[model samples]
Target: MTSLFPTTLFRPAAAVVAIAAALAPMVSLAAEPFVLQDIRVEGLQRTDPGTVFAALPFRVGETYTDDKAAAALRALFATGLFKDVRIEIDGKVAIVIVEERPVIQSVNFVGLKEFDKDVLIKSLRDAGIGEGLPFDKALVDRAEQEIKRQYLSRSLYGAEVVTTITPTDRNRVNVSFTMTEGDAAKIKEIRIVGTKAFGESTLKDLMDLTAGGWLTWYTKNDRYSRAKLNADLDTIRAYYLNRGYLEFAITSTQVTISPDKQDISITITVQEGQPYTVTAVRLQGEYFGREDQFRSLVTVRPGEAYQASGVAATVKAFTDLFATYGHAFARVEPRTEVDRATGQVALTLVADPQRRVYVRRIDVAGNTRTRDEVVRREFRQLESSWYDGERIKLSRDRVDRLGYFKEVAVETNEVANSPDQVDLVVNVTEKPTGNLQVGMSFSSADRLAFSASVRQDNVFGSGNYLGLELNTSKNARSLVFSTMDPYFTVDGISRSIDLFYRTSRPYNSLGDQYQISNPGGSVRFGVPFTEYDTVFFGIGLEQTNIGATAGIPNQYFDYRFRYGPRSTSLPLTIGWARDQRDSALTPTAGRYQRVNLEWSAGGDVRYLRSNLQYQQFFPIGSKLTLGLNAELGYGKGLGGRPYPVFKNFYGGGLGSVRVFEQGSLGVIDPTGAYIGGASKFNLNSELYFPVPGTGNDKSLRIFAFADMGNVWREGERLDAKSLRASAGFGLSWISPVGPLKLSWGTPLRSQPTDRIQRFQFQIGTAF
Candidate 1:
């Protein structure tokens, strides 16, 4: 029972006794009720006078008794504004003496660095310690403790917080908190006690947390995080389970912080149980009478290793299949029976096709700059329609693929009083889709080049792409402007417009450079034939002018003689691309193929050009990937005309055969000048490995590459004997400015007269 009056700090029971003793006189005098009394409150600095009168048990003309006094005391105490209360009566008049708690006049923070000041102030305000509120020492202490806890969560174990309060005029107090945030405890060691199937080094590679690394400051891979450790443990479990160890378990984990609170150590114990192989697999589920189609989705087979990943995939397939039938609540359960003696397991998958549900509403949020319709158009699921898991997942993926958001999430919330309805929330975190760049790059052939670009991917939040680029190099100077509107048509057809002016002095085999000036523009539309496929068709007009220079290639003069100093053409292009890569910038596992065809019919030199390319990336291990790319290009004259000398393909630079100088490959003219070929092919294969000191950072990597290719002149057949090849290694960094690549190639199959350029670099190519 709380006292109606303030109790002693040292002994609350004794204080209660004293309070009663002091009230005994009033109790005896109040045996008989008296009327016609006036009540007056003594202590009133900030509280309203009317409030005290309303809380008094006795009115001005009502009876004043002992019960009234006690009730009044309880009322005042319940208000939490007063600490002391006393009542006295003289001549049928009651006088009330009260002591009010000090109000908080101001609050301040000092020496806090780990958190923003506004955030800390709001946190403390939530804890009932801030300006304009009543001050309590206990609450202040708790706020200080909370501050320390927040720091500890961020690995600042040595942090400290101290709070101080000073009384002010009119019974007010000022509060201040001082915090000292120390160094974050970094992980000094991590040990895996038992490992048999895989080496410790390989297992460690699967975890993102490292004891120490060169990029620890940026990656924070050395700091101890409980959530990261849990994720790491999950990866370890998945690794063993996917490799056939069904009974694998993490036995124990210990995290020890050093006495100085600046270093941390972690140790983990694991049990690698006997590997299990599948003896048989059977499925018993409600597939809506489509068992044959569903059965084929199962990848697990008899006599194969018991693979958890395959089982999970089969389960998802079954679930997705049910979802296609509007079974929104469907679930597939897997049951395994293991035989220890035979080291085998029999698996059975059971399904429960629950009731269907419809989407009540689809709300989009967190797009501060982008319009809601910009996000809604990508969703395949519609409101008021039956919920489909496959469509919902695709909707989320489509939004992510836009590359406008840094993070995208979809959440399903059950509507109240509507068991069959759910609301979907597509939350996105917007990122800066605009960029302004000015930088320089150097290479052995290009020397030093300067470039700049202004691009916006989500212009005015309308989901349009606009870019202007300028590059000034020793052999080339160009300016280009481009724009693309992805929603040009409601059905998701994209339209692209481009205009460019370029002046190029291309290098030839004879070390001669001739200037070619061309200005062109094109308009293209991409029609999506399927989810992953697109067909683009475009028309363009270009005018090319050649400038004769001293020691220029003879082919340039010959083209000027046949087609005049300047010529114009109307070019038509048709292209097809199917991209299944997971990322546009850095793909881990996928295949991309494209074929582009171009022709110019109305020109002095009519020609046709075709290029076909295929690229594939295969994940070889947890930290290794294998990427292969091949391109074949050919050009031919049309209408019985000779192939245009200026319309030639050059191979042997950073983007092509790497061991030779830029544009220094192909048949040589009588003057020893390099004349580019009409046919070109390249085969590039790379084995990408994670950098050793960067932990699991995929942004930086080292790769070994083998490049083989050759260029054939017009009407010349491709021969293996004439192909050139090189094999070497390179490093790639996705730096803040841009992607940078450096390579050192060793010629393997090259002519003795070939211009050898062992080192090469490019500013923006990933491989």
Candidate 2:
């Protein structure tokens, strides 16, 4: 039994009713039957008198009995509008005394970090604990328990919730909930029992859930999650089923948490059945009598180990093939017949491709931020057209590439009463596209460089990108602001605006450490030529000034003498790129090519610059990848003007010829310093392998690379024998901050005049 009154003095006098039982009399005193002359309610501040009168069982001028008194008490308590109730009869004059429950004025959350305050308020409201509602002590206690359960699901088992209530005017009160969620419980060990066919390590490798590790802090893989464990069990089942152990099963799984709730242990038991071999495969379905066409798509071969993946792949292939021809409702069913004596299985693939359907409508959903048109314009398939699976898939991928969403999926719903018509629904879940980055790094050349950037790829959900970057380095400094709209026009045309102020010093130790200051702005447009290709062209105005520094190079003084201390150029740029990579971040097999050409004809430094790059990736195995890259650059002075010294190409860095000091290749001045040249060539080959103990995580990898490149000054004869070569090993990690690369290389071919810098590490970008 719980007391209804909050005060201890009143609680002892008030009746305590058990929720599991019916209401009973609190006092033994009984009243005889009498006619009621009047009935009145008292002690209500916010509740109306009519509300109490309507709830009373006995009315005015009615005969009140003992049964009626108990009935009235039970009826009034059921309403939960009163915390205290009493009835008195003064010679046929009945009076009702009541103390109304406090009305909730506000509900607030304090010290909440794991969940948003608004979300918590909404959940409480759904549980009948909101403003203007009658507040009950029991309901408040239940709310606290529910909140604790939510934290426990997130592995925060050591969470505490405290609730407070403050009395207010008009019989109202304010409720506040404070929370403290401790650290998540982590898995200390995972043991798998009854594994005889495969090694224990091999079985564990198939699961994404693992024990504690260094990367667990970021990945949270050690946290105890029931959903993740279930998913891992499914993965294990698939692993065994794919390898001919079709009858494998997980007998039991146990999860044990430590007393302090900081460490957890997990154990799994499994059973492995006899392996089965595939005897034959046959098709048994309505394929429009095109048996031979369907047979050609089967990936499962006879006399091989029974492979569940092979059968599943063949099913998907059949379904996709049917969908291409407007059969959106096509179904493929595979039935297996086994022989215990021979340990052989025969698979019968049954498919039922229903009537061809047409798209009746296209609906977009789950995009609460982005405009509907922004998603609709990316779809290649049109409404009211025959359903095509290929275009639908491409549309989903295109939306994904926008980088505004974390997930994108397409669903087909059959139109009711219209067998030949279906509706396509596109679902997208939005993610945060705005990023504030603070970067610091140390390199051989720039000992300590600091950088910061504010970028929003989907500004205000308008599909526009805006960025501002600040770089602090003694050798190079830049302040840039840029804006780009990917869908500037209806036909997939993009527009970009860029403004930058850059200053860089020569890499050489001699020549006074003179600097070049360049301020520029450009307006560019991108036109999509095909699904995987685009062409960009831009026009920009650049102004250059030779800084006043000590020990100015004689070439700079000569250039100033000939063309003054300032030069302006109106540059025209054009570029083309075609990427067919399976993934832009970590490609295992694909081809990429890009070419850019810049020409400045209306300035004092009239020159033509062109750069080309090509890359090809090959998958050595499921876990290994090989990549080859080559780049060639050429700049020539045009219109009788010299190629700008600030625009000259340079080699001998991670991006070019590694194992040498940055920009330490090319022609030498009179002071034994290597100045940048106008011609550059580079070739790189790398073999990437998985990181040890990381399984199939592509974000972390190790690679052995061989690099060869060189630089040549303008008017200097190009020689193949002058090229510098290096071979090394490097580690790459796509960390939370950014992509990090660390390399250690030894120069294989270096001349006496070359500067060597062996170790290099960089964050936030790839070389």
Candidate 3:
């Protein structure tokens, strides 16, 4: 049957060629005249005759051969205005007939629930099928296929499409594509076949592709895609190669479907060749100068096993070292010699520092969404100057730091016209920077709380930020509007202004609580001290009002008598920070430090508060990273007075320590409830590793974490040695949408009153 299929497919091609040759003889045998005296078009709606005549291959009084007629037919068909085309000759005159496809009166949709109707319409228009336009069978077929693809992308694999073609009274047709989108196919089980060095569970864990999990319902990673499978295979190949399996090869990969077409299984056959150890490494060829300096850059040891990562690192280090000496055209290639019998490998690195070329022009390409200045400003290696690899890398990093583009890359191309000068092409891919968050929470006393906020990080692709946030819930009310210009001055000084109002009901489980509201605004200015550091100063004014409310905790509220609707207070704030994390979502190596101090001279709640946080990351080996974070904060009233409730820090949930209940990490009253106060300390650490089966070495990582942090009253002295602690394990996947995180933490110092949290999962998290 398989052999017959290929033969059947070739039959039509053979027949067409044979017919064309056979028909040539009949043309010679025909008695018809060869020349036309005049030409006229019989049918053409909303089309000019001059246009058709101009398109004709043969002029009037010219020979009308078979080729000419075929050309005429093809020309008319290519216009996309005709439903049918025919050329008839009578004596010496030729008649052109065309039944033009109707111009669309209007294209619209009603009750569109599956896809955005306007977006669909735009796609159809781009496909040459839309309202107020002529159409052909080819266009209709293409439109249907495109619509199906869009639906499939949305996971509507079982969707059915029906087209309706209705002719109107005015020589027009109204085309409608009605769709019945059925439910999507949910993945049941993902199985990998063939011989394996690792177990199925271990292999599965290494895959970014999953069967079904909590996020699967949304991200649909479980859905099958051939492109995704190929990418995953490359990931698997990298994993083995980096681990010293130099001879690993994937023989074949197969994706099978059941009769129902809803279930799928993937099987990959791999040849796990014997692992090799590095016996020797030799550097040959020109070293330009300072051979010792280059030798120091070598991280691969002679006796160490062959690792792809080490090989790449050596290449990069060599290249950068050459660039530092103005050798931008340098090339370094590592050739491996493998001994099959002994399973040993030898690496020889050859360096050729070619004629150094200066950059004559730096061109920005493929940036349709971003302004030219936004990208050009990040250039550190200026044109008409010698190229420096370090500068180029820094320029690329600067562009990526804007957060406007998902990916930024630089390609060096030798200018064809000029050999001594190279043209640098900066490529950028933009991502959606607008975010909307709407969520609701329910508690025993607070029936249901709702909160929503919207912000745009990259406004107009200029790298500016604007946000209008609103949070209205049971105990908290806030409205904040802010704008930030990252490049307010050409010197890189950023300025920000914030307008905000907030009202809070300081809740206490006991019957002595108070209702306090603070409403105000602020203006801040920031200065970039260095590439990894920034400092900011701000001043704000707020009016505070405090009132007693029943049902508040008596032990805390009675002592803190209500006093508010007080005069305006001048509050000052100063902040400094630096971040060097590899990834904001999951740091591999770097340090992040921040310190902020705020003080209010006048208000119902006046106090001096300071917060300091520091995070450090280190690479344990090629495959693991260790991260540590610590935070300390304290608040003290200027005069002999009580600590401000608003200055208090609450821990728990995703951002804080994840083991305890939300808002339950702070000081508690007799009822074991959170009472507003200030003074806190926290410590956390995590060890991250690549998930076993996930072919992605960088995209997915698993971590075991320990968190130790808590909040205490401001009047009470803080005991750093007595901090609360929580320990747990979690998974981190660098998903396309964001970082997907899931952790289950348990309190290390469990008290009788502490609530234990388990199986806690969060999507799109940042640390």
Candidate 4:
């Protein structure tokens, strides 16, 4: 030591250095005795003291270090509710200092014209920005951004938002957001480019994409959305493929927006390839029986253009034919061979009949509103037997005809773990099949009128029909009840019965008005003779009570008086019906024809009446459908008797001719009163069109039609020249309530004495 301290300083210097080292160690030992006993916190408004102590790194009796003090400060700041944090140590005590953030007191909205106050508050709360929540700079920024997004979706591109924060008592704060929602943008136009196969107008008619239309109010298809545009493209593709344009393709599509963000436009590009024509067809398959029998069913003819629908029909027919031979497992595959050079095609048919297996079980699903018995009643074939395609197809058609479902489909499911069993699933989607209507109307002659009716196509979920109606209008009073069983017999026979009491007061402007009341009941049965034929018979009794009124035609009163009360008679009815409409409410294609005849044996006026009607629908190319309908009716009183006024025919209006007024087209008296009619005839033709820009017009149709019809007294025979003819346009829209029809009819032929009726229109009618 003496040598190190300049050994020469002195021998005493060495002894002094040794003493200092020993004393310094003793000082450190004494300082270590003063240990940290507890930790204390302040400036805690919302936070608990125990929470702060639990977060401390240095506990009681633990040595204090710089790292421990730094950790405490860091943890306090991590709470996200402090603006400042400080830690201090004094001897054996530790102190934590913090400036707590303000709490949200009451959040409110002002000048919030677009959104509700409660809704906005809830949205803020979801975004971690609401009352009772700690204030944060990052969260407030995120909330502002979210509000902007919500407004943009509503087309409020110019909307604005502003936030305000104010301090309150108890170290709390209040937040409010002010917003102004701007007007929504509207679509300007829609354009299609590079399309040749179909006209621009025609293509637009098939698309849901449009600038604006009635459906836009609900579906908002007018909005410029990518998803809607893509869907439209798919629609276009299906239109072409269904028509045998196999090579059609969509190259590209572009949607442009206006700089002002107030308008939008869409452009679609398409490539139409050469259409294929049929040149030849050959069948290459094993025919178990006579091959000639199967060949006769082919509807496809050589030299005709290839049509996908016709091809599919042929396959279906072939499969059905196989069923008659008990080969229900037969499969028919149709392949198309194309010759690009000649733009021609050849169809190759191949038949493969797998093992014939009996149907072990029939399963039904998706009939949420219909009972299983209703579906089972429509099955023509029994389960636990071999599958027959013919019966299966018929079963599907029967289910579809029930009218309780919107869609009926049969899916063949292969059974697992059972090689010889196949399951047939009949799926049906239920639709509203019951109708309830109540109406009140006011007329110049009648102060008030009311009518109510309840009709159900599916009764008790059994696919039957029942109806009751009552009308209390001043001009008409009626009570009626009816029931029908579409499938009364296992062989598809139908049964029906009707009971009614009706009274009608004729409108007579001159001398007097005639009124009569009749009460009767009838029962009938229908027996199917063929696929498109039926025979029916019935009997009934009735009583008529005529009320005499001034200006009433004496001839009508005389006939009613001739028929005795409680007239017993044997009535006979026969009818034939065949319907093949694509859709009943709005038919696009197919034909329907019916003829009915009725005869009374014992009555004041013995008579026979026959009515015939035929309707046909034909699709012109792919864009238009033409419909033609015609009806003829004739009746003659036997044994020199007078015709019944109630049984007489009345013309005009939607039922007869639209241009003419209701009950105004028949022979009239000098007082401008209508006499009974014994003969009638009607003819109508209409051309249907799709709305300018919309999807298929399944729920609505616009048409232009020509109608000609008239009624004549028994002595007055039906004549074409005497018929009243009208030509005009009309619209049919299927509303939730019922069908609404509006027509503008102008008489094609009119005379000064014939009333010269003006254009007429009507809405909400029963078909």
Candidate 5:
């Protein structure tokens, strides 16, 4: 028994040099092999002794040589638990002496307002520095730089980070990062150089990044971000390319910050080559024997100027068509042949159908609260079916329309070692589908209105809807409870049930004592005919009670006398609706149409009522949209009886021809009450634009509108002269509580007897 290896310290700071020095002693002990009787570890504080024992290459009673000792040392250092390691051998015992790195007691941040503390903590933890872990000086330094880099991304060029390490008892340390974040640097100037075909201002207008503007504070477009600048450059390049500048190129871009780092200047240099015309568009490679049909999808015309957008569209269409035929990996590349002398380009769409594949499986992820079945039931792309791009896209849209998720995405991944099979992944980010709202609104007609609703669109993650709503206003009060099962029959058919009680008092009514009370319940079923169309049918039983008071309208009194104070009606309703809008909350494009018919053939009331509505929106530009809406209503007696006065249609208000009081455009009773009519027609046109300080946010917009409509009695002739017209401007906002609309209308054509209300507003209503 004798000392074989001398104790030598190894530090990671200079691992190469320290390991070389420590190994020098081990070489002398290599020739002498010893049988270890015991192994002991020193400098144990927070780390368990078993951790060191597990990493050792040799155990007690095993023969230990220089190679095993060196292996053990390397393994121990790799654990990152110790900052210094030394092995001492005395006779038949091996002593592993180590200096453990300080465990992080706490990691704190000071003056951290730009980012959440937890976010920064997680970032630091990912970088190997956090509470409950060994502290590394190099990692701490790197983390400081990373923090500064994050601030720089937010345009805070003057941001500075200082890391402080404080040692505490029990081999623990506290780490604190103090940040001094100054003002953000803004783009003071942006210039596009080498632009001759178009004005510099015009080209700059196409870029999202811009100099300081009134809206820059909110939009942050003036912030100097490298990613944003790159995106803007792409937008500029696309603009030129779409305008026939086939050889347009961004030669160079220069971004410079001021000495104080408070202002930044950007200059983009472009090479706008000569514009080219399309000589011909030829299809090459393979068309799967559908050459003629593929040719019809080509959007690049031979006689038209060369447009990159057209070429891109043609390529996408070709690939999409191929995908519909089970070619999941179709590739369509546009090969351009340019004739410089003639300034003409010949575009050839090269298609490669590759290998046809079918879906092997459909996987869903990212739904924590909602059940997986809720999302899977919406998919039309079935497993083990031929891959259809159109069906996959439809499935994504269908899941998105459910409103249970914030984001719904479908991705196709090729299966490993299976070229003929692919897997479809549906990723959904679930959002809160339950809403409890209590709100108040005001309007010229309804001075004060209160509303409360408890709704769950995805009740218990079952994809069912349950809601209870209560609304009270000066002219109307209603309480309704409803529920809907979207997959009632598992064939995309829906079923809905509603129970409601309503009380209504006409505008200009003398008192609340005279009113109409109606209570009803209905069960409706929706049958889907197409992707965007649905037909609904339902039956309802209602009882109407007309109250009598002084100064009551003659029409209502006469009706109650003939039909009795209480009248019961059994009504059958059928409706058809088609929604093709890009968004239900903020529609910028597409059309929506609806038609409803209600017929009461039994009980004390017998009549037929029909209503039709059409709406269309046209996106004029990036920030502007035009919308048009038309509605018509008609009612008639079916059994030689007069149409129910209590079932009349009303017009004029924020929803109809504004500037006229609510429900004041119909026939007026001799008692001065506004009695609505059985026939109504309304038309509306609106131009919507982004608010001045809101940038491209569609949630806030300003619109100019023109409304024209009137209500007439069932037997009365629909007179053009009687129609009321108004023009006005309004503000629309999708607020946290609900959709809010404020309008100020001036009557362009109004009768002297008509009640006028120039201003009106409401919440939770949409056009």
Candidate 6:
């Protein structure tokens, strides 16, 4: 008997030709065919022997030939479980030997602060390198490089990563990656060269990227990033193009890092050519037989400086108009013809309304916590309907207004093999909609106030709002519970229920003995009359108890004497509100208006109260905004009964006129207590600008404001001379906790008896 050793090992890592060449000699030596008695696999640790046998070409008692041996070798090596495979034949028996690759037992990271451990593990797993898989040294090396690359993207120039493998029991290995993440590189200098039309500083100011500044530590604008630089370049390009620099071009940009790898310098060279004026504007293309309507949307005009923004707006308007007519794939191309001698350009807009399509389906994604119906119900562009850009935009805005999602986006996708069909996908990124707040505040009137609230805007993903609040202060105390169902009915009518108990006292030197205790509950329904308007109707029952204290005001005694100490009233409310602000929290542009009317008809206290408010914001340039607000309030007696003192409108507070103490601008009683009045008017104007060194961030701003307002008793003439005026400067911050406003005002017009509080601040208030 002769024992033959193939002496050649087969591995998938090696080339097929090399593997086949090594097996050629074995095949030639085993040319004679023989029937195998038994087949046995060797060197199997973690892998089961059945796995090797399953990949073999022949079973026990089968004829094994040279071709079968070659096929078996190829088959076993393809499993990737073995690093080395060989075959031996002795006396009609076949022997199989496989050296299994070590499996990865565990993966870990050390000194990795820039990324989470799971994040790196997931990244490695995506690259076929994770625990419970066959370990490949090449894949581990690539993963180390990938980790370093991620650090570099965050401006960590000096970051280093090292991979260590430790052999464990059962032919397994544990992988460890150690990383050293250094400080991020900062932009030391940013220089713009060859700028004549605009000052270099002005051009640089338009960019979001900047050199090190006092606020850079917070904004991170000083950190060097390739993506940020590219965005800044685009901004610069747009700036020049909008200013009529039709031939403006960025010649080159150079970035250099210091030897220490902590400092970076950027240089951008731009060519500012001659400015151009529009010679003529022409429209050319299919207009769906409504050329006049499309022409009305053109903004590029002759005898004016060429503005890229105007051209872009005109193109967008044309495309959007087409989209509104079911042309979902509309395209508007603007072509420009420039004459160097005259420095004049001719602009032509070309519109192409491609195949019209109707939405075949609507899908919502990324709403892991929110229900699908909560998002679907907001859609105005229904499935199976012709595409309408305006309705789609309205739907997106409505979803955004819910304030439940951090981001909402609508994407259109063409249906496969269907030219006239499309799909609309609404993607929403949900944020935490539940908030628990416990805080302390101070004011001139409500001194040392403590408040607590628990609120959920998206309760159980039902798109309902529930909240409970408790507030206590030196002059007032209150507890309230409220709930709202935005979609109470399919018609978009909203229902709100509130139950509250409150106590109040006049802000005077006198103690809290002179107080008013009030408790009430109300249910309101909001009916949407338009896309931006809502009318509300509700009824509430309240009881006002005027305390018969030692220092009680004459007005309070008058009301109590007429309606008794405890007065019960049923008030009916009707209100309308319209909001078109770009943002409710920090509005830069748009208008808001609200009017509310309350009437108590069938109660001991019969009166009418009406309030109207209007607010508008105008954006000035890119970094400044102008805001204006006006309010008028009136309360009149009815059915031969005077207006209730508890329902009187008060002025002079953070939300009203600043500088004067809260609720102190109304009529004063002989006892020196501020008795709030029945009629009020306020006018406020503010100029807001970004904080210096903060770039274009609107979250933090500084504003100068002028406020004028006054409160008058019932039947008192509305006199301009009686209004108190103030001018002040303040800082506004949309902080993580809430919106904060701090103001220091000086009275521009005041009387000697007016109580003044110059420095004032409040949280959760926006104007």
| All candidates in order of TM-score, best leading | 5, 6, 2, 1, 3, 4
Q: Please, what is the TM-score per model?
A: 0.78, 0.79, 0.76, 0.69, 0.85, 0.84
Q: After superposition, how far is residue 473 of candidate 1 from its true place, in Å?
A: 2.8
lDDT of 4 by residue, 508-603 (tens): 658466677878888878887765467776676665666756676656655545764233345567777787778777777998888888787776
lDDT (10s digit) by residue, model 1, range 594-694: 99999997866589999999999999866788998999999998888777777788888677888787778886766666677999998899898877767
Pairs that collide in candidate 1 are: 509-674, 510-674
Q: Put the candidates in lDDT order, highest first.
A: 6, 5, 1, 2, 3, 4
Clashes of each: 2, 0, 15, 7, 0, 0
Which is the winner by lDDT between candidate 4 and candidate 6? 6
- Cα displacement (angstroms), candidate 2, residue 595, comes to 1.7
lDDT of 6 by residue, 523-631 (tens): 9999999998899999999988888988888888887786689988899999999999888888999999999999997667889999999999999988999999999
Q: Which stretches of candidate 6 lie over 4 Å from their true place?
A: 1-144, 162-179, 365-372, 415-418, 430-432, 436-451, 472-476, 505-507, 511-515, 547-554, 557-562
* Reference-based TM-score, model 1: 0.78
lDDT per residue (tens digit) for residues 32-143 in model 3: 5476789889887688888788878888777878766766666666565666666766777787877887887766554357876766676566555677877555557556
Model 2 lDDT per residue over 539-562, tens place: 999999987676556666677778
lDDT of 2: 0.83
lDDT of each: 0.84, 0.83, 0.73, 0.72, 0.86, 0.87
Runs in model 2 lying further than 4 Å from the true structure:
1-143, 146-189, 212-220, 256-265, 289-293, 431-444, 447-456, 459-461, 554-558, 618-624, 672-674, 687-703, 715-720
Alpha-carbon runs more than 4 Å astray in model 5:
1-110, 116-143, 164-177, 367-372, 415-418, 438-452, 470-478, 502-518, 543-567, 601-605, 637-641, 670-672, 691-695
**Predicted structure 5, TM vs. truth:** 0.85
Task: Select the stronger candidate by TM-score from 1 and 4.
Answer: 1
Model 2: lowest-lDDT 10 consecutive positions:
4-13
